[model samples]
Target chain A: MKTSEDKLNEALRSALKRKFDDFGDQPNPSSYDLIRARLKQPRNYKYLLLTIALIAFFVAGVMIDQHWITTKSDVLSTKTGIKSVMQKAANLDINQAATTKNQLEENDSVKQSVSEPRTIVSSTSTKISMSSVVPALSPATLPTEQTNIVDAPEILEQAEIAALPVQISSISALQPESFKTTGLNLPAITITEALKSEPAIHTNSQKISWLLNLASLKTYQILTVPKSGDRNFQNFKFPSTFALESLGYKVSIGAEKNGFQMMLHYSTFRQRYSYEIAGDEYVVQAVGQADYKIVRPGTIMNEDNKFELLGIGLSKEVQWGGSPPRRSPQRRSPVRRSPLRQYYASAGVQYSHTLNAGPDIGWINAGFGRQFAINRTVLLNVGPYAEFSPLRLSGKGDPFFYQPYRVGISLGMKLVRP
Target chain B: MKFFTSNKYKDLTQLVRACQKHDPAAQTVFYDRYKSKLTGVCLRYAKTRAEADDIFQEAFIRIFNHINDLKEPEAADSWVKVTVIRTAINYYHRTTKEQELHSSLDYTELQLDSGDYEKMMDQLNVEELLSMINELPDKYRTVINLHLIDGYTHVEIGEMLTMSVATARSQFMRGRNMLLKKLEKKGIVHHENF
Candidate 1:
């Protein structure tokens, strides 16, 4: 026999059991079923179609705009410059030396060769003329036979007619023959040497000018100026400029150790100058400078000498779609495309700040990324992304935001068909 | 055992498949088949029938929404059970404060006439044996409910509650001792030989 207490406890247990048993027999109609039913209904097809169409339209527009901007800017800078040089050549008389000097100076190489006599010569003359100069100067007086002078006289004569002054500087300052052997740096006599040579001594200044004019015409032939009809010019401009500006970038023009630079400026995001260096090849640099923002306040300016390579060989035209057709003979040539075509893999360590409904927080991430062309117009990139942020330090003492570090994979593709 | 061996199992599987396809009739069948089990889970956490019904409905809704994430169809019973438990815990946490503040006014009082009371008393004799479990604390109530009614072992209970098996066993023994003491005080059942 049980006491009242024991009976009460037993009764309570039985009640709990009965309650649970009731649950086993009850029906559960889930709210999720209604939602799913609505989603699965055929009547929603029109909305689904409209959503898909809108997303497709957005993606198409972005791709088209990216292609347009890239092509336009590339033509404006690279193609236009090359075309102008070619046009100036076609209109001028090859017999005139004065015009030839003007044409040669316009070439970026000639401008860069201001300090070197050999670079000056190579920038202005053809191979035949360059060969003629080698024999005229004695081995002892000339820089070593790094540049063969078989045709040195022809180049020297033309330079003399163009009123270039020839200076006999010891060859010690010149780089070795192997260094000068690149496609752009051919051998020839400098203007200074030509001015002092026999041709200038024998001819009257007016006669010399006539001969210079004729030589300019021939010089034009060897340098292929980009033609006006070049399809690249028509499409490669706006996209490249737009791409940089959309990211709040401003462009700066100048020279760096590697070559001429077009830098992208972002004052708020980063104090450093990000630029594309265009010379032997295109390189991307992130240059650190003293806080010139304080000195020039609100003005975007180039650093005098602080440019360093963050990465290299980034071609605006190729990225933006103004890239010349893949099947073109010039495209096939390693010399013409090699500089811009090389792939680069880079690693960067960054500190990023994120502000959310919680507290402002900071994180550190180290990433390694590789950019390579799938074809002339498409680029693919993949990288591992890992970020570390302290949960305690994030979101202004909010208990709900306690998720710490996030790790994931990032993959990207760019259509560069220009 | 019959459910696993009989044609009803095949029918249940077919109903589940139809439910996956969003067939209303199949969903109704699926609901009818499993509703009782889910309701039982809900009742464990809810203080009243209405609350339990709400929890049961909500648990089913969550099941339908997240069914795609379930990798194993054979584990559906366990999966729904776990989901219901989690949902009930969440509900408890949310409503405990409100329930605590209104404990007095919300409490139900019972009244009976002498003759009716005698009949009731006879019925209560058996019920009283189980009702004493209500005097136990919430944690002990859950442990006793799981162990005695649901037939879960201490190790399994420990895993569900994220506690060690030994801890679950110790808590169970402690709850049993408390119940024994309360029964002795009420002059209910006397403990003699084990």
Candidate 2:
């Protein structure tokens, strides 16, 4: 204790304590007022995360929807010959039809057909006037001509002009024997050409062309366990009634032609509930193997979780009413907007493998909805949908079983028709 | 200088209880009681007064937010002190500006002298001593303050600064010798034996 080293340590400690024990003085009251102000602010991160996710998904949905609509429409107009049909229809004049008819009359078979009772209805008609064309055709020479046309392969080149007036099956009925001698089996091509030549028929057949729908729904999830008495599935039981969950959103793009559509959609749901799990570690195999440990046995877990599901589906929709006629600039009266309405029923399979160790769900969902047009291209769609999980694949030997049944009403917007 | 004895909430436990309830009056009194001591701790770790104020503000905010988790109210003084020190260290870790300053310092051995560092300590005023400490690189100054002034062991310093225990000890020795050298340059301590 009396050593110089000991004395030096004591002296240094005392010096430091003397200088900084109380320091010079307390800060001014105004200086620490800032801390007090900061303490009053509150932070709730759960709501913040939910808000950010919702906004991000909405923006992404809109951007993707816009992109697909633009790209699909552009492809339809350019590569599909629909552009040629529209151009030919818009440029339809009596002089052009006469020139085309005169061109056809140059053939020896066409001159013979003109001498017969056979009538060549001009392609100038916007509608598919097959009824008018059929009545003027000679029924006697049709079968014999069809047999000749079937044998001659070179005649298919002129199938477009030949099939213009009649139904595809009656291709030979409109032609003379000389034209039918160069036979070709081109029924599919003949049908397509028949539709294309008549722009009005083509436009009407392709109605309700493409639609983009954004939906918001209040969901109810029913959790149930299978009756199969497997010891590995004993931890969960079925709920007899539905529990109302939070709202979710869905964005879908469907391409419809001739009242049938193929739809691809993405939807998100937030499930919030409490359930008891037998506390133990278990391995279950779903899309891949997974290891999970539910905290101690008999522990009740409260969850508020969000997951996404991607699905592809096919649907049949029946539509009535037509888009309103464009108002002429000469008519000053306000044009009343009448929107087309359609009803559709769809069935689809949805799968989600990413739930952070939760069971993967494979659901078969059936939905029906009605669309009311908001304008020429946009519509409001509202409907009810139900999803049932026939298969719940878990990691191997997983004790927890989840059979999710979801029923909800969705209100959405449909954008753009072809 | 103001002392804690002048505050209305003289008992540490009573002050902590009222602060936990988020009472404005109790919070103000609690801050007044610990401001000088904690700010002094922050100043030793920080390079400047503005930096010290920032650390102090952040530390107090954390203290109030987590004060509800404290089981013993009487220990609020030591708890608040620990929080401030940890906050200052974290602040430095976040900034990472000390790497440049630490790299510039020369750690070459100086002339060995068993000078009377205790006698040098007596001549220097608090401001002069703190000024000399602040002049040292952040790495060495922090180790010196933690080891000598606060009396934290080398192992504790290593853990707090996320460095090896041997590094902490070396830093403290270098920082101590630097302070003695500063005192000698000031003509306050003459090495008669050297």
Candidate 3:
């Protein structure tokens, strides 16, 4: 005869087993299902998720602040001073330079600020111009100063401000994201962002200004490249979709004004992909995509895969937001654009040649971004952008190939060259 | 309002997938599948029936919240149990007052003879045995259930309970000793076994 102990143990195991599988659960039923349902509404979940995300963002901001602000170095002090120099430069009316030196001696703040010519030049002349100022000038401020520069050949301390390199270095040291490059130490810069970085230089009537952008980007492409003139191979398909990475800088020197501005910008985007030509359906080629002609389907092999793009773009910016230039209303001066508005949108027509080799492709691109003053010197720029281009890639025997559009985003910091 | 029917999932993987998607019926099924065992786990750690209920509810909530973080769906049973244990510990920490120095305890090992509990098993039910477990101090019960029933090593128990491995082992031994004495006093285990 079996002991009741055996039955008790058996009952416990039986009670714990899940109805469908042997997974354990007691015989007791619970109202947890009903209660959890009441508690787990989608709206509640969304709110909870939103709250958590907000907390995370707050924590991240705090962390970034702590990390960036706590570090003390000569580099930091220079970056800190870049903003003051920009602020003062924008309001400078260097035409007053002859009189400002006299005031500098009387004003303790200005006198205290005095230092050796070399240290002041290296420090105040930021590599990147601070683009923070609204650039809004009363007719009496910048316009009058421009008229006086000719009268007084003793341009005073205006000669102390080194124009282009200072803007580049200052912006590079402050933030590398804005203009994406040409601002601080960046080699490539957005045209409008460059405008903001060195408005101090534009305080004069210059036709051309330097722009740089610094950024790292990666993208992928999938297309069927058509073979040339070989009508039989024209329909050949290569469903080549792979990944590529790029780390490059762009540089632009643009002609500027208060109404309309255009820039000739160039960039080199590099890509890396895996190429295995196992069949005609999947043809692998070099990094710079070279057109392939296939006579047979499923008859190719994979070997080398790498592509470099040398891209050139003609970008345009219209300062429609600027207050119509008061005195130059009929002329539509670019200065009419709201001098206070530091944000702008840009569009461009671009061409890319694969690594000084491969097919030349064209793209039309547009983007919108904003610059916020982080401090007197640093400006944070972030934006979303899209680029459209033709997918003229094809190989032999590929009957079905899909070409998808490409889009990307960029973030950077620039010096607020007031 | 019910959004799904509990019996729809075919397997643990399917159930876990449904839960990850926040499928109402799948979650109900998951709850039905694990609640009883998890409640049993809660009983070992909580100081009272109300506390056990609270721990079970909190543990299930946590499990659902982090279901996607579980690396292996097949290991859901062990993972759920571990989560409940941690939740119970957390509940203890949250509800209890400030902790003081844990005075050293000198409890001898408990030895059983002649199958008294086996005989008592015929008379006393599982709920009664659970109640007997509940009689132990909260710390001891947690240590005992985690080490013996849940099969957590002393190091694991210590880490879970925020104590040293030796402390976890000692608490388990002391809890076991105290539980056996209670069983003897209640005649569930014969007094002569000591």
Candidate 4:
């Protein structure tokens, strides 16, 4: 009943099984040992990836901090100098009160009532209506305001006050014995101390206020030719180019409420475009070994012209991190410290117009960064960011074209105000 | 063929369980047990002893690495053999540089008598038969080995080789005829039957 094909298959299978089933040959005895050795060896790729991650983190930290680019606002010496100027102004005001008393009584606009003793809360802009008259403080011969409201300190400029001669004396003239009877419980604060205290008081009232953040970006442009059937465009190579002109800058003015910042921004950057030809059909020769090469007769091209762009956008911030603790409304703390740190991510769309002769483009942008508090009112930030654009930028009558996208690091400062 | 049918089967199961945990001593025993059988497989698939050794070692490494994936320890024998065969195929596919040349060969005109082929296979020794199989083109040799000696169905061979079942069957026929021609050239079978 068996056919020749079945018989042939049976014969082959029977012979193969008989030969190979119990077949044994001596292999290199070291094969198992080699396997053991290989298994024992640590995986180098995991370590390599870890090392690369650490190096990248270190480099990004260095780039973000930029310790070499320290601002005057960050220096202790500048703060000390400002404190000294304020101290001298306070001493001058206390010392000159007696000398200027006769001149103060002659001005009809100024009224002094010595009978009813009350707290003297005086400033150039504000006058407290009390049972006793409070004299308005002027830059020439007047004591500064003793109290700082939710608004900033209404004090004379330190430069104007520090220009006068100062004497070391008790500030009892500004804080009279009668001030204690008024029961306001206000401390005898000097102009120097008031300047130090005003920021905390002002920030407490500035929950939802306007914030202006300025940013500078070092842009890297990505260029690609549009997919087309044309052979010339397909064979073109776009090598990346970078220079000082590649640095883009942005200014965002927005308001933040409950950690959400909605901003309208204006950004600007310049692009310098260039490309090279590559194909098997055309013989290629480099022109000075640059990005471009000569492929056809009179087809040599090299462009290093500036294309300045002015862009405007609207963005909203998404912040996620620990925030500063809130203060009770009824109980005010005399001093408030800055929060440890904060982080934010933002996304938006932008439309740009070229200041030079070029095509206008639109971009969708996103960025994330860590914020370092410089003070209660100002924060410094640095982060990696990217922008994507779909518009094609091409030369008129040129066969080659490219769509552009940009990636960059944005360094900026946020200034908060009521 | 039936192998490890009784107490040896229990030992193989225990050995596989130990190997799954990557016990070094058990791995050595497992290696020693399967080495000869898998080597026989590699030798048939490879052209030379050195290539066979390479495939055998790579196959064993894969067997040890993936042993933990074998849910039923009883299937270790078949699993190991399948791993060895697949490793050998992958090794040959990676190293074969003349694939285009082999694919361009004409297999349509090989007219041979199956009766003569069947008669010749009985006289041929295992070494001679293996040599004839090795002499065939890579595609044909692999298809013949997978379908005939390995007891794989044409559908299984097609899936393994990434070809249609029709192609696998046609390739086996051509390879069988080529082997018969070699036997005829050696005077072991007469060509007049064709």
State TM-scores per candidate.
0.31, 0.36, 0.34, 0.37
Q: Docking category for candidate 3?
A: incorrect
Candidate 1 lDDT tens digits, A264-300:
2111111112211112222233456632111111222
User: Which tens-of-lDDT digit does each residue in A1-418 have in candidate 4?
Assistant: 9986777667666656665566556554434543553352224687489547645544554343333124212322323444443333344444344344444446424322221212134333122212111122232222334532111121222221221112112222332442343323433223343334433312222266566656666555434333232222222223335556667676666676544556666666655544433333434566775744434322335544455676666655544343465432322222222333366666667777877777787887777788776667676777877776756567434543445566677776666552
Better candidate number, 2 or 3, judged by lDDT: 2
Residue-wise lDDT of candidate 4 within B1-194, one digit each (tens)? Answer: 23333343257778788777667767777876787778788888988766786788788888888888899988888999999999988987898776543332245343445555555665656677677777877777787788777889989988998889988887777776666567667543433544
Tens digits of per-residue lDDT, candidate 1, B84-149, equal: 876765666566553222123122232322333233333344335345555565556567667756
Candidate 2's residue-wise lDDT over A1-418, tens digit each? 4675345456666677667776643442334544654574345577479547545544554454445446445433433432243234334454554564455456537533332222222232221111112333443424333221111111222222233323333433332331333332222322334333322312233466666766665555534332222111223332234434566777777776654667777777766655454333434334535643222244555656676767666654444333454332322222322224345444555665543445566776655677665554556677876666776443223333445556677665555543
lDDT of each residue in A269-305, candidate 3, tens digit only: 4433222222224233445566533222332332223
How far off is residue B190 in model 2, in Å?
Answer: 10
Error of 2 at B6 (Å): 9.3
Off by over 4 Å in 3: A1-418, B1-7, B98-123, B188-194
DockQ of each: 0.18, 0.23, 0.07, 0.24
Candidate 3 chain A, poorest ten consecutive residues by summed lDDT = A114-123
Calculate model 2's interface RMSD in Å. 3.2
Rank ordering of all candidates by DockQ, starting from the highest? 4, 2, 1, 3
Positional deviation of residue A108's Cα in model 1 after best superposition, in angstroms = 37
Deviation in angstroms for A163 in model 3? 48
